[model samples]
Target: MKKEILKIALLFLSITSSSTFAQETLDAFLKDQPIIDMHFHITKGYGDNEIYRHLNVDIDSAKLYWAIEDYKKNNVVLALGGGPLKYAKMYAGAERLFWSGLIFPCTKTVEQDKPCEKEFYSESELREIYQRGNFKSLGESMFNYYGIPPADKRLEPYWKIAMEYDIPIGIHADSGPPVERVNKEERPNYNPTYANPELLKPILKKYPKLKLYLMHYGGEYSDQSLNLMKEYPQIYCEISAVSMFLPKEVWEPNVKKLFSEGLGDRLMFASDYFGTVRKNIEIIYNLDWLSEEQKRDVFYNNAARFLELSDSEIREHRKKLN
Candidate 1:
């Protein structure tokens, strides 16, 4: 929690050095809506060292703590959780510390000595975990990976469980070239090309009812993402980390193109805000190509529909119809 707080403080410090933003803009924009951040990460002992090494950014728990406090102060809903499923317990603990909404079926691998690992949990054990915490959705599951194909028979058990619980499953779909040329800087492993729509076609056809999120706008293979959304109303694309990292000149046109192509309603906002930049909210708000209403949908309403928040909650945060 402290880390999030410090990051916000840092953001403010950074901004002040440049120029003071109009206080009214900050207050009105935030007060007018419930900014539910659909993507965040949490874990313990999993060092932030890698971020500094690759991205040259230093992050810590104190920064994240500040971020959360600032979000709450501004009436934002922080959808927080973590994985790597090996350390699910640690992630769960961190979620509670921040009073965050958890994401289930995280990819954290559990060691036998760890509190969370036990080969597999019984139905009761699974139910107990669900009941114990406040999880906003069901996953960060990598359905498409080598050895573990998107349509792999092994995932049926996990799918069945998610269906029984009626939670949204956030799946990883790699929409890029082969991994060999990929680098540590790009986080290559996460972008498995095999997870393309051609691969997931069978899986989606079979599990037609699964509420799934295609992370990263399926990367460079965005058309495949569009097709999936067209085929399945249950499928949504999360535009979080990708938007932040991409060159704005490129993103603005692509975002406009996505809407022009009729994929607007299915696009959801997820900042992937972890121990990283907290000013993304402001950056996104100021994106020039997308009109204010489009920004509101991306940042607010789309997520509200998926999360199924109450009408009253929606009314409280609805962006005014200009």
Candidate 2:
């Protein structure tokens, strides 16, 4: 398949604009480009705050006073952020970010029950937020870390709301942090099988129209993610940290495998970056295997199509960029 899309250089935006605060200069090809990041996080507590020690920008904690501006610098027209409603409202009041529901349920375990756990919206609470038009999607759900599956009965209410409102659900169906690197005190339960994409089969059958975005490209179990997508048209995957964290040799093959399966259009881009948004975007933008157009879809079109962004909304995003 000869790759068909925009020219490489044409896809960049060479900018010295004030929007970027004079620190990051975007390539000209990406000038005023539109990208929809399907995975991002905002938490009341520290979450993957130190995943990439190589990057100069360590969030230190969940301090996000710099997050909104970071999004603007990298041309993230829209982002599906996973976190509590309280923080979502604070950040998204004027930004294009949308809350994708809670990342984890209130803790049944002692550690999670403290100052932050209760902040996760309950079913009734999410419904109220939805009613007020504050919430949009659901999950980025880290069920695996909790040793639970997507089909667990405890998650029924979330599925119900997703069906009722037609919002997409994002699941962390990827492997957890490397064993040696797993936080010392917070060694998560970290069940690999719990991240299995097949667990979503029941959910699909129950809510046929519901959209599911599997974050991390299924991590080590990408084959499972690929299989599920084959079986269920509504299933999509986000190539988040896979490109950023894995050895390119390790992760690139998986990406090639996806295109080989003809799942390119269903594939979406995500940084899940709490900082240095351009570092995340640029990696995908520069994929050796991707043509300009395929990169375009991953960055913007696929997500826009998946989210069903209205024409007006899409136009407005580009309007701001130019």
Q: Choose the strongest candidate by TM-score.
A: 2
CA lDDT of each candidate? 0.57, 0.71
Residue-level error in angstroms, candidate 2, position 320: 0.8
lDDT of 1 at 184: 41
* lDDT, candidate 2, 249-305, per-residue tens: 887788889999899789888888567467777777667678888888888998888
Model 1 Cα lDDT, one tens digit per residue, 1-322: 9999999999999988655555456557666656666555544333444433343233435444455565566555536344433344444454422223223333324321223234234566556666675544555554433225655555665566556766676665544335665444323244466557657677666666777777767356577777778888777777666666766665566566678878787777665655433466766677666777877777778877876778876664443222
lDDT of 1: 0.57
Runs off by more than 4 Å, candidate 1: 1-28, 45-64, 73-75, 84-128, 131-134, 143-147, 175-191, 312-322
**What is candidate 1's CA lDDT for residue 47?**
42
